[model samples]
Target chain A: MLKVENLHAGYGGAEVLNGVNLEVKAGTVVALIGANGAGKTTTMRAISGMVRPSKGRVLVEDLPVEGLAASRIARLGLAHSPEGRKVFGPLSVEDNLLLGAYRHLPHFLGFRSKAAADLKKVYDLFPRLEERREQLSGTLSGGEQQMLAIGRALMAQPKVVLLDEPSMGLAPVIVQEVFSIIRRLKEAGITLLLVEQFAKSALEVADYAYVMERGKIAVAGTPEELRKDERVLAAYLG
Target chain B: MDTSVIIQIVVSGAFMGLVYALVAYGFQLTFATSKTINFGQGELVMLSAFFSLTLTRLGAPYWLMVPGGLLFGALLGLFVERAAVRLALEQKSEGWILLTIILGLLGFSSAENIWGRDDHPFPTPISSDPIHVVGVDITPLEISVAVGVLGIMGLIELFKRRTLLGKAFEAVSADRDAAELMGISSTRTVMLSYALSGAVAALAGILVAPITTVGPTMASALILKAFSVAVVAGLESGFGVVVVGLFLGGLENLASLYLGSGWREAPGLLLLILALALRPNGIFGKASIRKV
Candidate 1:
């Protein structure tokens, strides 16, 4: 459902993503794993229009969306939960979620009611969020914030979701909980492109996976095939 | 001097202070969304009042003239955003400060050409005769200023709190990138803020014009005091501006009464310098913590 072709992007004259190519087909979880500074995050950002690509194309449902404004890309049904869980700090959790559905919901009155069902779905996925719906999102724990980020992305009901570093800065227990939520999302048939530091867990949940090196994809295979690659096992699994 | 006389001066001054609060609120609006404010806001005030005066002279009723003036102000605001702010913000530069100031100067010259250099009395159906209430005399014109200022402020505040679009505005203010991911356009939000700021400035002009008279320079002193209020109260809090505006107004009146009439502008300047030196973030503003 989402495709990237020869994407080249960077900040200021320093190219971080050089001719990186990838795809996330409908109803499958694709994990992009690599060590620090391997351009995984930049690739996600370029795909979502956060960082404009220097060259190449990004397609959401086969429509070229390269160089569009991030909000325009979002309205076209691509939701990106960026690194750092950049939730609106002063807003309540419910407001953050409602805004995630901004393109679909009414701009003025009755938006709360229109978003009621999506809110319920997210709250069901993370009951902790429901309990703290009225609380300011900034005060939430890291794990809760991660859940809110993921929940917020889901609120958009987008065609594809790019989730970057969902496990960053969390306890192992919380990371496990996050993965379980990912598993649930996958089971529910959501198309996702996940970037992660934890290769083992990512491989376990991914239907297909790509290992990135420098600024390009180094290996691509099914998760089962990836698990048996000696080089992949040595560098990442170890 | 009688205590009642002192009460009258403070009360009257407080009403005028509310006008400053209204203009300061305009600065807060644009600052919230884009972190940029129009340096030409005083000119916007003066121009809108002149426009309303022309409308009155053209035989438009007060009711029709008010909305007409506000709409004109909103369009001028959009012009400022497009001409002065949008490019600078996109390029991530502070060039807007100079650009808006230049635009204000152009507006000042234009007003001179169109309305002439002399102050003109603003005609109003509302009588200026003071009404006696609890041993104090207050004019309907002054009461209308308070009501208009507070009414518009209340309505804007309500829009921000109760509407989804308003929440989206707050979202952009809090985090621009995250808001974009949510499909909220920060550029449009900034535009909306500028438009609202312009409308508010126009309302301030309309409300105070009857008392201060309509002239190219009418808003010069008022804008300075409003700037002081915005700085002292902090640009983020709506309620803070009103409180600080009222306090500064009363203090200035008392200064003029006791320390000579020439001292009218002293308190606002002193308060501004004190706020800058002691509380740069403002009394109501939270100290921002940079998380690396």
Candidate 2:
């Protein structure tokens, strides 16, 4: 559903993503695991057109989308839950979710009614979000905010979702809860490209996995194949 | 001085102050999305008023002219965004400041060339005849200003709260990047804001034209005071500008009454300086809290 070929991107002169190539076939979860600065986030940003790739081709279901505006990429069926859970702090949870479906819904009146079904689906996924629907998102706890982020991305009903560090700065218990949500989403057949620091937990949920090192794919295989490899076991699983 | 006279002066001044609030609200609209204000906003007001006056001269009625004038203002706003602000915002530079100022200067000269430098009396259907309420006499012309300013502001506030597009606007204001992730284009939102701001500025010009007259320099003093209103009230709150505008309006009138006509402009400047020195965020503006 999503493909990147020879992606190169960076901040100003410092290149962070160097010829990174990866793919996630439809209806499967792909985990990108690496240490800090492995270019996981940069890869996600380049795919979503947040950070313009100096050299690369990003294709969403065969439509080349590299160098398009982030907003344009979003409209073309890519939802990016960026690192740091960048929710609109002043907006209510319901409003945030409603905005996640912005491209599909009407711009003016009657949008609430049209978005009701999508809202219900997300609310069911995270009951806590429904409870605090009217509350400002910024005031939510880190765990709830993370759920809100995932829930928001789901609201888009996008062709592919890029989940970036869903467990970052979360409690262990909350991290487990987040992983369970991913499992549930996998069962529902959501196509996702997940970026996670928790390699073990990610591999458990991912059908396929890629280990990134210094802005390139160091290893790639099924989770079981990766588990049997010594280099993958020592460098990441250890 | 009779207490009734003081009330009369304050009331009249307060009506005029509503115009300042309307213009300041224009500043708030653009600032909400872009974090930049058009320094040439005064010229926008002047130019829009002149355009409206031309419509009047072309034999259009007040109702027709109002919408016509607002449309012209909205177009001018889009032009300003395209010509002055968009490039700077895209490059992430502060060049918009000088660019907008130059646009304003160009607008000023354009008005001089098109309409001449002389002030002309703005003809209006609304009567200037004062109607007495208890002891205070208020003109229909002034009442129209109050009604027009409040009506537009209330409509805009409703737009922000009730509509999905408006909510998108607020989302962009709150966080530009996050809004983009939702497929809400910040550039379009910013353009919409400028259009709204321009329309609001045009309305201010049209409302005040009968009392102040239509001319190239008509909005000079008005825009300065409106700036004071925006700064003193804080640029974030709609309600803040009205309260500050009214207070500044009344205070200036009282200052002129007691101190002298020469001291009329003093109070607004004083309030602006005091607000800037003491509370730079504005009396109604909340201090932003950053989370690491």
Candidate 3:
């Protein structure tokens, strides 16, 4: 459903993502697991058009979307829940989700009623969010904010979602809750490209996984194949 | 000293202050979206008023001229954004500060050349004769200023709260990147803000033109007080500008009455300095608290 080919991108003079290639097929969860500064987030950004790629092709459903503005890329059916849950801090939770569907919904009036079904689905997935629907997103706890972030991305009803760091700063228990939600989303057949610091949690749910080392994909395989690799076992799992 | 006389002075001063609040509100509108404001906004007011006056002279009725002026103002605002702000913002530079000022200077010259340098009276159907209300005399013209200022403010505030596009506007203001992720174009939102701000500035020009007269230099004195109001009230709060505007206006008239007419501009400047020294964030503005 989404593909990045020979992508190169960086800030200023230094290059961060060099010749990185990755793919996520329809209705599958692909994990990009890497250490700090491995270009995982940068790769997600490049795919979503937040950071323009210096050279390469990014295809969302086989449509090239490399050099467009972030908002333009989003309109092409790609939702990116970026690093550090960048929720509209002052907006209400429901408003955040409503905005997620901005590309499809009416711009002015009757948007709420139009997005009712999608909103209901999201509310069912995270009932806590429904409870705090009117509260500002900034006031929510870290776990709730993460849930809001994912729920917000789902509101877009995008063809593919790029989730970066779903468990970056959270307690182990909250992280577990997050993974369980991911499991639910996977079972619901949502296509996802996930970037994570926690390799073990990511590997358990991923259909295919890539271990990134210094901005390049060092290894790619199924979860079982990855578990048997000595380097993957030593550097990440061990 | 008759108590009603004092009431009359304060009421008239407060009416003038509302014009400052409206222009200051224009500043807040653009600041909320792009963190940049048109330094040429004062010229926007002058030009729109001049244009509206021309509309009146061209056989358009007062009702027709108002909307015509507002439309012209919004277009001029878009022009300022395209001509000055958008480029500087794209490069992430403070070049807009100089660019907008230059645009204002250009606007000033254009107005002088087109309409001449002399001040012209802006005709209104409303009576200048004072109406007795609760033992105090007030002019319908003055009352029109208050109504026009508060009315537009209320409508814009309503739009921000009740519409999806308005919510998108707030979203961009809150987090431009996150808003972009939602498919809300920040560039378009910024453009919309400039347009709305332009409309507002034009309204200020129309409402106050009758009292102050339409001229290239009228905005200079008005813009200074508006700046003081925006600073003292903070750039974030809409209601803050009105309250501060009314207080400053009342103070100015009272000062001029007691301390001599030269003191008319003194209170606004003093309050601006005081607000800057004691409360830089403004009395109503909350200290921005964001968790990393």
Fnat of every candidate, listed in order:
0.86, 0.81, 0.83
Candidate 2 lDDT, A1-238, residue by residue in tens = 9999999999988999889999999999999998889999999999998899999899999999999899999998899999999998888999999999998999989999999999999989999999999999989999999999998888898999999999999999999999999999999999999999999999999999999999999899999999999998998899
lDDT of every predicted structure (CA atoms): 0.95, 0.95, 0.94
Model 3 bad stretches (over 4 Å): B290-292
Over 4 Å off, model 2: none
**What are the per-residue Cα lDDT tens digits for candidate 2 across B73-101?**
99999999999999999999999999999
lDDT, model 1, position B21? 98
lDDT of 3 by residue, A86-197 (tens): 9888899999999999999998789999999999999999999999999999899989999999999999999999999999899999999999999999999999999988
How would the docking of model 2 be graded?
high
CAPRI verdict (incorrect, acceptable, medium, high) for model 1: high
Model 1 lDDT tens row, A1-238: 9999999999999999889989999999999999899999999999988899999999999999999999999999999999999988899999989999999999989999999999999999999999999999999999989999999999999999999999999999999999999999999999999999999999999999999999999999999999899999999988
Q: What are the models' TM-scores? A: 0.99, 0.99, 0.99
Write candidate 1's Cα lDDT for B1-292 as tens digits.
Answer: 9999998999899999999999999999999999999999999999999999999999999999999999999999999999999999999999999999999999999999999999999999999899999998999998999899999999999999889999999999999988999999999999999999999999999999999999999999999999999999998999999999899989889999999999999999999999999999888888878877
Q: Candidate 1 chain A: minimum summed lDDT over ten consecutive residues — where?
A: A15-24
Show model 1 residue runs off by greater than 4 Å.
none
Backbone collision tally, model 1: 0
lDDT of 2 at A68: 89
> CA lDDT of B105 in candidate 3?
100
